[model samples]
Target: MSITAQLRDSVRLPGGDALVNGFAFESRGDGPRRALLESGHELEVHDLVEVFAGERAPTAVFPLPWPGWGRGVHSVSPDGSFAVFSGQRAVRAVSVGGETLWEYRHGCWGPEIGHAHTGDEQEVCRGLEHGSCRVSDDGRLVWAHVVVEPEDQDWQECWVVLDARDGRELARLPLDSAASGSHHLSHPDGIHMGLCIGMGQDGILLHWARWDGAKLTSWDLNETMDRILTDVHTGLPGFLTVEHYGADLRLHALDGAVLAEEAPEPADDEDPPCWDYGCGFVDADTVIASTVESDEDPDRARHWLLDARTLEIRGAVAYPTGPVDSCVRPLGDGTWLTYDDTSETLNRWIEAAS
Candidate 1:
């Protein structure tokens, strides 16, 4: 099956240095949509959200905390009222007016800070770096991986849930892994979340959790497979998409069961086609997957559409433009968004009318 996407609209990013990979979108009202953009280099970081509506200039611009280069964990609330920034030493909640609502400090990113350090705050750690955090779907809680120090023992790392409205610690769960850092994947249910941790060659760790009002429950699939989660299929309740070690795309249940799997069609004399870690469902029945730039030919990349239930290749997907990055984000509707780093523009793509 062949899939064609029409370019709905393109919004040029504010700063020429916008980090395409760091962009995130949160919808508000019916008029225009807002998205978070991170820019700047090294220690100088500027994070802001730009409202995109037709051809008019941005109606509003909201600033967020500057997340340093290495620690890039941050999220805007769905309602676009607040922003949360998670770094090596702290997680803070800031209001749209730039007020620091509250902050929670934790262990440092490493045993010692790198030369990139510029803040006056002093912190220390046991070499655990690359921490991450995400806001819950309801925008009421923040799930974060942080270091917890005990009075009689050395520091340890754990997952902590905080009240997003005031940054109050609500719950904590100790984690056992070799994860230097991790990323949080939010579920549409507002009660479940997934954490993916990369531990060098040891393999990846998958932590699935459910948060009730009273407690937090979780299960981890420890180094079972070298897979990176691409999309959580909320439509199917327990199903999600994963790129297995960059080799094949697999549909997996929340309990680590492989439901279905498939790889891209390989060319005659060329190398086997691999899927990029960035992929997701365009709807209940259609999945959008992309190819990574080949190491042998860095400029080569392509997109593939697949049957969500059968894992069959429906067809190759073509965009109006020449090439795009591997970061394909689903907008919950049938439409999706892709970023062009070269042009510093965010393009919305929707299936052409039948």
Candidate 2:
């Protein structure tokens, strides 16, 4: 079935440099609502209800440790009270009021191994290799991937769960892999969080962990596949992952068994198609994905809808408003987001009613 995109509302970003990937529930006032990644190192909270009503001002803004170039990843708490940044040498949590609530410093992400001393803060801002963090559903725990010092080892990258109320370390697990960067995907059940570590040409590493108040339990993909874990949802029995180079999309069983696979089947005379690294379930039954990077001509970039369980290509998404400028970020509520880099505007979309 062919699906068309209908615009419900949009807002121009304050900095003209951000996008709304997902949302958070406010602890008060029907919850603060939407979230905007205001550049890689900065995060801004806003009310989607207000943005839909034509107000675009951020309700709260947070300044992160590293600049955008460092490519660190972060996570915002569910209550919108604070955010934790996985910086080059630390995981720091900052309040909505722009105050540093806590910071847990660890081994540097710099290339200079065997160096016991860390350089200036400026050096931390410039490091390229990085890690990621995520706040638990209750906002009481933080899971992070960072370089840590061990008694018998020089330094190693590991995933650790921390006390969200303080910076105290709780439990840790060795990663045994080098990271160019990583991110956490909160599971729909809110109990488990998925970690995706991108190691450039060395391939990708995927992990899942849960902190159950008593101990930390975790597992990994065992380097079984060169896949980028894209989306996880309660509605699906498993999760979705696209191949590292956008070759094919796969839906996997919870135990990592492939349930279905979808690959580009271009017309014989057309160019080979490729999917972007981003793809997610727009709703329980529908998956939205894009081919922006595969298009040599930007104007021809396309988005497609798929059967979430089967990975069957429904068809390319038709945007009546014209070509969408950015890849779609599925909201999992039958809607998604796309930004216009040229205009600095973010748009929310839904399927057009027949």
| lDDT per model vs. reference | 0.66, 0.76
Q: Which parts of model 1 have CA positions greater than 4 angstroms off?
A: 14-20, 23-34, 40-52, 55-70, 113-119, 122-128, 295-300, 320-327
List candidate 2 stretches off by more than 4 Å. Answer: 14-33, 39-42, 65-70, 113-126
Candidate 1 displacement at residue 124 in angstroms: 10
lDDT for each residue of candidate 1 in 237-319, tens digit (9 for 90 to 100) = 55555654577788887787888888887878888877766677777788887775543553566778888877899887776
lDDT of 1: 0.66
Q: Residue 15 lDDT in model 2?
A: 46
| CA shift of 60, model 2, Å | 1.8
Sliding window of 10 residues with minimal summed lDDT for model 2? 22-31
Best by TM-score: 2
